[model samples]
Target: MSLVRRIMHQGFMPLFWLALLLSAALGLHQLETLFQWIQPDTRAVIYSRDSFLSLLLNHLSIVGIAALVSIVIGVGAAIAVSRPWGRDFLPLVSQVASIGQTFPPVAVLALSVPLFGFGAVPTMFALILYGLLPIVRNTLVGLRGIDSSVLEAARGVGMSSVQVLLQVELPLAMNVILAGIRTSVTINIATAAIGSTIGASTLGDPVISGLVNGNTAYVLQGAILIGLLAVTVDSLFERLQNSFSVMEDRLIK
Candidate 1:
């Protein structure tokens, strides 16, 4: 039990990412051999050559950029709203985030396509918007929940406002902030699969192609890869949560 806990605290994100890459690059392409026997009637309509790897890479790249953007904006906004000078804007912030999420990713893409043209730009715009709400909400919740006395004590110690926030509050709130990030990233992973409709080249390529060509194999392949990717990243986030718990305990002690 202790050993398992230790490993969780060490973080499994790197391993999960590596395995996801290897499986998508090698395992995904070879899957047709096994799937062929199950659905002999349907022809494989997968990417030509090892283009599956390129598709997977492109998929990861776009999602990665979107998630990165979402985190920056979400976390920054949450921090600003949590502060004294920014408290009045909390409602405005909440409303904007709610509206961002309420607007469908497909609509965001469709509307953006006219301005940005078909490809990664529109898809990324959609993804960043789609991913923002959870991050901002979670961060705001975490910061709000921090013990007032903790901040008071930090301030009492002659620490400047910035020092208290960076050295004390941020660390204490990190786990909660990360939980919001996990939710943000997890939701975006599956949402990003649909980015292919706008030509962003993701695991959704097979799903879109399969639908167009009426080949279940293509759909299954895409779904399997995308599902695995989501699950793997979720596990990584779980590990990160565990790791932060351990770190938090150590800091408290």
Candidate 2:
């Protein structure tokens, strides 16, 4: 299992990201010069101390945590609603998730600030709300779209409800669920930079600082890194979904 995981890690996804990584490497080398061009007209200050890797890692941690929260709640709520007893709550769950997202992330951050204080916590709360709708919507769609015959066959084999759900239904629906996650994480990667406004250290820190201080260089730096991070993660998720599809095909054969 460990060997399989290692192979999947090293051989599977990285192959898709080779070009993106190379581009980022090249961009990092010219990051300072790139900043100068962003505002040649203005006396923009470029602080070269913060490396792209450092900023990227900080951004990753913030978005990573919030995405985890989103997946747990979004997927769990969908699963619950798919169950017989919880089926009645499907509309309610869907509506509530819609409402949560309709409330702006900035507004959510403002509300959470009083309770959580100014930090990543409020930012994470806002993003968790932001990421919920797609995941829940997708999971519900995936589970509901499953073929009845397949489910009945599992049940005919004496599979318990739990076994059928865990071993059969979820595995079949895994790619759909993961697609939702892919969307959520990609969106969050760009959105979590807002956390910088409230004191969370992220790639957005430079952007916000630039906006406030009128230094276009900082904004350019943050924007480039955030865009690259989003692309990197989106590629990884795309590769993962492809891998799941291949695995599913193998099982069918």
Candidate 3:
């Protein structure tokens, strides 16, 4: 298949999800009667405190920031510990990342609130902490998975350490690293919704409000959007991973 055609084919599903997500967010009020049925006793079936689009954007921003930070720190740490000179610290770094992952996101959020004081910052802080494990672990797996013979060959070819890492090691390990990123981001998307409980403006707001007010309609609305968003992102990552695999195959050939 032509590159353009292949690209389009791979992109189709994500585009479809994006369209559905937009339609649901924008046309939510049109389903008022349906929501009313879900929460028959509530005066307001629609979530009117904020638009779904705004909440979605806020949620994405929070996750995006956290994911970016996590990627940088996680990837960097893994790379550092993978180096010959840094090998002694590998166990320590892994332990730290594992501990961070073991910490409950809700507990992190609650703890950060006192320091960051109730906003997107604390939520992001919690997300970054919770999201690091997958990324760090995957990066380590990717880097360590490289064959020693490959590195020896690279060095024999007169490639500098940096050159081998940048040109060969990274290229080979990219897919695994990306898989980690996908896992981290997907988890963050779901966890970020919980930020609403701590005063962060997120899709979780409706769900929290719904629970507080005993309105199932509000809860359903938030859930639908969050689920759609997660699927969309996951689809996007899958497409990216496929593209990377194709490129790597081409390079190998």
Computed on alpha carbons, the lDDT of every model, listed in order, comes to 0.79, 0.77, 0.90
Model 2 worst lDDT window (10 residues) = 2-11
| Backbone atom clashes (below 3 Å) for every candidate | 0, 0, 0
True-structure lDDT of candidate 1 = 0.79
lDDT of 3: 0.90
Task: Tell me which of candidates 1 and 2 scores higher on TM-score.
Answer: 1
In the order shown, the candidates' Cα RMSDs to the true structure are 3.4, 3.3, 2.1
| TM-scores of all candidate predictions against the true structure | 0.87, 0.83, 0.93
Which TM-score value belongs to model 1? 0.87
Say which candidate scores most in TM-score. Answer: 3
Instruction: Locate the minimum summed-lDDT window of 10 residues in model 3.
Output: 1-10
User: What tens digits encode model 1's per-residue C-alpha lDDT throughout 53-143?
Assistant: 7777788888889999999998898999988899999999977877777776667767878878888888888778878888898788787
After superposing candidate 2, which stretches have Cα over 4 Å from the reference? 1-45, 48-50
Q: Cα miss at 140, model 3 (Å)?
A: 0.6
User: 1-253, model 2: which lDDT tens digit per residue?
Assistant: 8435744675544555655654663465465566567677665456454666676777788888888888898899999998999989999987776676677667766777788898878888778888888899888878987899999999999999999999989888988999989888877776778878887778888788888878877777677667767776786777677778888787668
| Candidate 2 vs. true structure, TM-score | 0.83
